[model samples]
Target: MKDCEFFFESKENVEQDGRVILDEYRTHLKDKNTREDINDNELLEKCINIVFEHMKYNRVYIYGIGSSSVVAREFKLRFMRLGLDVDYLAESHSIRMNITRVNQESLVIGISVSGKTEEVIEGLREAKEKGAKTIMLSAARVYEYRSYYDELILIGGLKNLAISDKISPQVPALIVVDILYSHYLNYNNDNKKEKLQMTLEHINYELEE
Candidate 1:
């Protein structure tokens, strides 16, 4: 039998290597302009208006799979805390099954960075057929699926660099989410701030227990 030997780098060397990796990551991110492209004030304002209109009288259903699903869940939680009737389905099967609940009085948001997820496209298509307002967040302008969604919010970044795989795929979508959330906080006077406060307090209380 032969004995196995293991070697570990010193803390100083490990930290130096980690710093180099982080520096490269930051450089790549800086070179990426996806967020800048989405920072169009006019477009974002229009989207805010559309979402607020639908939210006033309808329920919200967000759908996404894989990394996009993470964005959907975060959006749901943030809006829910603001006292909005919002929910999310991250799995293809769940989205298909619960999609029946969507109707004219519903707002469906599909997050697909690549703009080619079949499940996301199908979900938006069905929602449109049911007379629900549909919105899509994607990096690519998928002209083929134009009829499926009422609004298309284009995500910005390196379209050719496959940045999502190297970093977080949901970064661009999350930027839009935060923008919408801020708009809602400023525009709505439905005691949403109070609701947010209460939700935060509840979470803290739970944590302290």
Candidate 2:
């Protein structure tokens, strides 16, 4: 048996069908989870103020590649649902051309899992130069390009598993976006209590099912 297989489980070859959804909650429970060192309230408040600041721009540009792109688009739709102008860039030139068009009143949210993706890093630099405010969503430990952003939202700790299968990374990214959605709602909506209650209901439903 391969070392990875031996290290994880025998069920992988027998029953898992080579697909595993990395159970994020289980991963967290494996360790004594700690809240991120950064102030949660401050991050949420800043994101809200930033959103309000660009309310008139009617265009929020989001750029990310691979799995990050999926997360970015999720946020775009969430914001759009809240009546904000949001766009997700899909192609290379579409993003490059739009960079010149972005204004000081616009916001560009860049998502990079590693915090070092060349395209994402370079894109944020271009957006910043165009006078658009930038926010980075990453769990990156250190990045020299950090100085260019107006806000940094850390998603919490990351875990690497030795399971010998292709587990979907997209789900975890989606969960982080959901967390960000909560922060946005907390900061902006006057009906914050109602919104929080709804979210709690959703979580409970998921747990029960």
Candidate 3:
């Protein structure tokens, strides 16, 4: 009868808070969207050229936490499928030891919703110190270490929440990472566009069924 009761009854079928948040996130995509969308798209365009210029060496490192880390993994997989050398650093020990040094030509892509995440920031810091080209995907403004990074891609504007946050913020962050994937496709002359386009056409055709 009630929402809580329905949730309890369907506990096995229904997912918990994480799923709820993700579902709400998907739904929020249908909504009009917020200011973050514009900035994020801009960042995507700016990074595409740089990514293309260094297509060689092929090594890429991604850093982030929580959902942001999952997003980074998806980006890494997309790059890998496109034949680039991609690596993931989501843990404390691996991040510290594995990424100790990076090739000068390598690209280190860092994604952080808060931009204030200590681990990702520190990892990026290390990568930079070791001579890797650093690129940041963050919603927060550039901080004191601005000179250390090669590029900072800002996604989403600020939106404060009291008790619970609206989905308006989360979806745009996801979309920004997706935009990076799209940008890679466009930059590398990859068939992801035609492939995705064809897939969408098929989906639409099937929906008609």
Compose the digit string of candidate 3's lDDT tens values, residues 1-209.
Answer: 69989878888665675687686655544434334443456566767766665566657888866667676777776666555577878776766775745767778888777777677788888778778888887767766768657888766544541112755433456667667766778775756566555655755743334
Q: TM-score for each prediction?
A: 0.81, 0.71, 0.68
- Top candidate on lDDT is 1
CA displacement after TM-score superposition, residue 99 of candidate 1 (Å):
2.5
In terms of TM-score, the best-performing candidate is 1
Ranked candidates (lDDT, high to low): 1, 3, 2
TM-score of 3: 0.68
The whole-model lDDT of each prediction reads: 0.80, 0.67, 0.67
Residues 1-209 of candidate 1: C-alpha lDDT, one tens digit per residue: 12322224356677887897576556544654554556767767777777778777878999999989999999999889888888899998988997779999889999988887889899999999999988888878787898998878876654442345445768767877888789878875678788888998988844345
Instruction: Compute the lDDT for candidate 1.
Output: 0.80
The residue-level lDDT of candidate 3 at 116 comes to 71
lDDT of 1 at 103: 90
What would the per-residue lDDT of candidate 2 be over residues 1-209, giving only the tens digit for each residue?
59877757766554554333435445542433315423466675777788776866657788877777788788887766555678887556677777777888889888776676677777788888878898877657445786667887765444542121343444445666676666776665665456445656765733345
Clashes of each: 2, 0, 1
Q: Residue pairs in steric clash, candidate 2?
A: none
